[model samples]
Target: MLIGCHGIPVLPPYIISAIVYGSLFALMSVSLTLTYITTKVPNFAQGALVTAGLYTGFALLSINKINPYESLPLSFLVGGVVALGIYLVVLRPLSRRGAPVISLMIATLAVDIIFVGVFGIYSDYLYQVKKVYDAKLFFALTGADFSLFGVNGVVYTAPIALALITASLYLVLTRTRFGLAMRATVENPNLAKVVGVNTEVIYVTSWFVAGGLAAIAGVFYSFWQGGEPDIGSVLLISMFAGSILGGLKSIYGAVIGGLVVGSSEIVVTTLGAQYIGPWVTPYEPGIPLLVMVITLLVIPGGITSVNWRRLLSRGNGS
Candidate 1:
């Protein structure tokens, strides 16, 4: 029911939903991939960090009456602190002790479990103490959203935020001294250390950046979809699927993979429910899993693994 330029009708709610979800997923996938590139450990707690942001924004909204959009900076800081704490307290020590990659990953999973409990406790406190009955579960207040050209505010905000974040990251990574050191550290920590770079500081910075990105994604997610204490855990599979589909090491690939997966998850399900049956709705989560499996089977290296130049040359010759 939205009007486009020239009074044309465009961008139904479902399409807007896809765009917002895809943007947020792309942001999260970039964050997840960044951590993996920096520290060969897959952060299972990434989702929990996202939940932390969700709660932070929710708490501000319910108590202080701060808009979720306005509370994003605080959410980023909180999530960054939590992520940095995990790196410093758990991963750093074990890493120094030469713990295996699997062990480090398991430690992240343990931290994720711990966060679930913490979020649960916080949820209880919010309901009992703050008396926000919907603290345990909540959706975005549509009334608070503005419309432009008949599109919801989030339809503009999510994509714009993703673009800004991506541009900022690109500038930081490719055009700064710290970025040079960080890239060197990522390429080879020992070599970077021997060359006078502080790999530990780079690691800390990467984790903090990753956490902040994930939190920002979470805030957008709450604006696009509803949020709950454990919703991040539920979305963890999708996040991993996006990361894996992107080849896990390429940040740009992660962005593309997330946009593909996120949009398809919602759009495909909606189409199926409209044309096939209602049963398709419940199987939406399977879309990412199926995409992940297909990616693994067809192209283990993911989308970035394909050599576009070679493929184009073949087409020209034909």
Candidate 2:
């Protein structure tokens, strides 16, 4: 029941909101899965990349007065650089010294802690020196926006960004030589080295791509929901839930898991508010935790491991 400025119509607010949020979640899940595949690290610092992108977008919009869309590429580069630095300086050296996976994962936790401090300091600086208002958890998506056909810029852009990233990933994984090398390294790093593939380069490239995707998703998310310095930490659970729901091993499964988790989080919360009480909305974040716990108990392998054809046949009694 929404009318556009050009006399066209767009989806209702709730549906549009779900789609936008779900798309961003899907993008993050895919990015996370990619990182896990290549590095065998769950990457707790992934959330910091999102936070970095959020601030990058805020700086671009508030200080530079740049369009949000224009900030995405810059955010991607910033994220890539941060990710590369972590890998090259910290993770790579640890690996060279034969650190275990647990040690590497802990390293990511350290990185996350460091970034939180950096984000907090920057927030203070922006508020005090730059005179930005409430910079810590600043909700900046107020009057600054553009409209497309009949939809807000974010409404169209979020899904489009996800689609482009997905398509590009498919092309890179299937058609590109670098992608082949990456796959080889992920499958068997030792074997890849024996076969002349540079595992170091593949690892670096994977981290870069993962960071870029996380940043892009953060920018899209900030567009619709507004940004906060620690917003990524809050979202880390949902990201993990989606990746786990997807079996944590398959990229395509991550997409399905994210869509399901993201859409259900909103839809179920809305229904809960309607039926249970309005107060249920405040506990919306609990939904992902419940989903993740139930998923681990019922189907640890996740949606990708299900025999969909058999299940459909049983439904038809065939």
Candidate 3:
């Protein structure tokens, strides 16, 4: 049982899990939304880029014995570089040739498949050369965590990281000249280019930022849920759901959408298991899928598209 700072019982494990998962999901979703806004391409390989970060942190921890938190900077760089490479090597050339959006999306899917194979090869290398037998399939390294008031360090760290990242993004986007250029580029690339905004640089910078954010989220996710080669693939659905629910067009919306969907996935699944029996546990992934479907059917434009003020005024009038 976990205790609070004052010795009273803290929230349940499942709730803690929800907070950590939701925070990570929000981070990843924000990254996805940023990429979409800048490039207008739904990066199917976003999950694989995250997995690259997961492996980066995992490799440092498993081999160098470095703390996962300490490995974050390197993970960010690796993820950013890979994502930038993908954009330059694959997407940009295709876009230049006037490839359609669907083709660009397919290219991303192909990249994801390639990443899976690469991760598999790396996993084999870890097992064969490094002798980390569980490199391919491993559980969380919770033993590396320090307890805070009997709660795992991640419980606080995850939310703190999310808060800091979001705040930093808000400042960067609002206060910087580059951010103004980025906004303009996203709004209209040709117009921004005409004004000498260097839209190409903005696109590269945005992809790098998005990849770094996803990788940072990946590092935390490995700490919370364990690292695996295909963990990103497993998480892709939830990330997309969060992005879509948040109204893919708004970065802030992604945050809220991620928190809601991630929390609901865990809480709803746990509740179902408790009340409906263990059989419901296997259907855990369905929760986010259902939420996505319902969101699409009802509010296709997402949470950000809804006019809460008007709705409230109408309620008052009634």
Candidate 4:
């Protein structure tokens, strides 16, 4: 009875999917932007980081019989550790050797391959040791969810999580000393070092934070959409599209970019399938690819490059 009082009308599946996926993509895009700004390397392994989180939630929910939502913090911590390990084992050594940016980027691709291999092994081990079903199987927590205000818990939780994450990131970047140091390090590592900032530590911490956020996004994604070990690879194109659309240099831009990409992916794909023929459904993956190419061609600097002040001034004058 109490739940009934607070019930809000439900939305169409397309709209609901857009909101949920948009929020998740926002978290991922922002994390990728942060990694790019600090490390100057577009970490291809970011999808793998999200997969790591999804697997963490899977273990907690399926094996431990805990609420899937309850696993977020642990997933975040584990993701941070995984990201830090990558830096220590692969990227940091390459950086120390004075590798070019292209080399560093390639190194990230190598890390992605390594993580894919690791996930494959881990999936096998989960089945053999814990009697868990094939970890590569697509699975969702739809049955595990409770409703709120007559909406699927995921519908509300995803947006709420996005708000909290965005607010928290803003505060951390603007109000904290670490944030200041991080910004200094990102702007100019040598200058930051001259000013006594530990650039190496900052870089490591940034990677950890980025990985942690990606993990949280993955947790929500698993709740809304079933996941598998290779799910990250499948989602990587969309994540890259969101990050690139936002202007890889600006974290704030990532929010807008992710929302745009996510919303368009669902809405456009659904509409296409409805009107263009059901056969169009399988081509859904091409949406993000199209967006990426268009963005690169039309706005390589992303939406951030637009001169808002000039546009406003012209409007006022007119």
Highest lDDT against the true fold, candidate = 3
Candidate 1: tens digits of C-alpha lDDT, residues 1-318 = 866788878977678788988888898999899889988888999998899888888888889999878888999998899899889999999988999999999999999999999999999999999999988888875555677776668889989989998889888989999999988888888899999998888999999989998998888787767688888888898888889999998888899889988999989999999999998899999999999999999999989999989999999998
Identify the candidate with maximal TM-score. 3
Tens-place lDDT per residue, model 4, 88-177, is 888889888999999998888888888889888888888888888846685667877778655678889988988888898889879998
> What do the candidate models score in CA lDDT, each in turn?
0.88, 0.84, 0.90, 0.85
How displaced is residue 307 in candidate 3, in Å?
Answer: 1.2
- Positional deviation of residue 248's Cα in model 4 after best superposition, in angstroms: 0.2
| Residue lDDT tens for model 3, 1-318 | 766678788889899899998999999999999889987899999998899998998888889999988888999999999899889999999999999999999999999999999999999999999998989988877876667877788889989989998898888888999878888888888899999999988899889989999998888887777878888888999999999999999889999999988999999999999998989999989978998999999999999999999999999998
Q: Name the better of 1 and 2 by lDDT.
A: 1
- Candidates 1 and 4: which is better by TM-score? 1
TM-score of 4: 0.93
lDDT of 2 by residue, 116-157 (tens): 999999988998999888687766474566776745688777
lDDT of 4: 0.85
Regions of model 3 farther than 4 Å from truth: 1-5
TM-scores of the candidates are 0.96, 0.93, 0.97, 0.93
Better of 1 and 3 by TM-score: 3
- Can you give the lDDT of residue 43 in candidate 3? 94
